[model samples]
Target: MEFANEPIFQWMSQFAYQPGMVYAGLIAMMALSAVGFPLPEEVTLISVGILAFMGAHPAHFPPPYEGAPVVNVHTAAIIAFTAVVASDTLIYVIGRVFGRKLLYHPRVHKFFPEHMMKRVEEWTHKYGAYACGIFRFTPGLRFPGHLACGMLRYPVWKFLVIDGIAALISVPTQIYLLAHYGEPILKYLRQFKLVLFGIIGLLVIYFVAKKIHQRWAARAASR
Candidate 1:
């Protein structure tokens, strides 16, 4: 609903106004988003849903032109799902082929860092194949977790199965929900965004406090 006034609304509306540009753009952006680019995949899907609600096809695109392709809920979901899986698989392969050596590279470490990689390494060892599914739900953890899974030599078939299952649960849900309930869902998402950020901030504070306490305790014990 807010897209009516926003710049992105104007930008995406151009694509939405066209009969087929929505699908092409969504597939491309979704692929980029899955690979950890800053592109907002979920927001784009929701916009596609709204476009579906408004009938993305031109007003003249009814009747005899019904056979012609246009952006719709089903097509959007399928394309998004496939794009997500493909991009994620590509990242997994990059990690597998390059292994720990890539993860340790200074340029890569600037994004993935040694600490995050170590945490992901522990998680992979603890959870084995299931960690792939776990990482699918975790945004910041995905790059490192998937990479760690490969560096740790997790089975490729198992990685695909787990990641695919997680994608099934996450991908279609966003597109269909927005398509069916655009305004209310966006409102809820806006509110949920604040709450989610607050929660993450509190978790960060708690962990830092806990680490400081542990360090102090260790010093006292040494004395």
Candidate 2:
């Protein structure tokens, strides 16, 4: 995939000239995501990875940005890792401070639907602090899941250890791999973008059908 032709890359490239701004933006995105921002942190991470790749291969970018300072891949990875852990910890703190009350708050409740909240609770009940890893891996569940961990009053050290390990395994590795092998990966993504979209669409339909089936079963049981 030509970096210049990709609109996401084009938009992010504008910040390559000011690496500090890029880092700040990434931290802000991660923090917002922790508080249930509609955008996923993965999008920001992937964008950072692509930006790092472009920085390493400035010639691949168009003019103006071509001469800009590079966004160091390692530095970006460290910043991303730190930002993710810190933001997630903030969610944990909110849960700790407000306890269950935060969950019932009108604004907060809207972000976490009942079914999803049930799933988070189930995972926590089953796995204990280890469930923090599950929440870290699961995109939609992260915010509420982390909050639940805090609400349960799991040890701060345990939460940090578990979440940090998960972040270490996922966050920096993604940026590093993309920085090193982004061209081929992007090429494969471009080629299979339609296939990926189809798979995602099918998954959505399956989940919706399952939810309807579950509700119907509950209604029948009540009758």
lDDT of 2 by residue, 1-223 (tens): 4636766557666665568888989889988877766566777787788778877766666537335676788999999999999989999999999999888675566545678889999999999999988899897789899999999999999999999999999899988888788898777766786797687688668756654675566556547
Highest lDDT against the true fold, candidate: 2
- Cα deviation at 14, candidate 1, in Å, is 4.2
Taking the tens digit of each residue's C-alpha lDDT, what string does model 1 give over 44-126? 77677866654543442232344455457888888888887887888888889998888777555555544666778788888
Q: Give per-model TM-scores.
A: 0.70, 0.79
* Candidate 1 CA-lDDT value: 0.70
Colliding pairs, model 1: none
Clashes of 2: 0
Model 2: CA > 4 A from native: 1-12, 62-67, 189-223
C-alpha lDDT values of all predictions: 0.70, 0.81
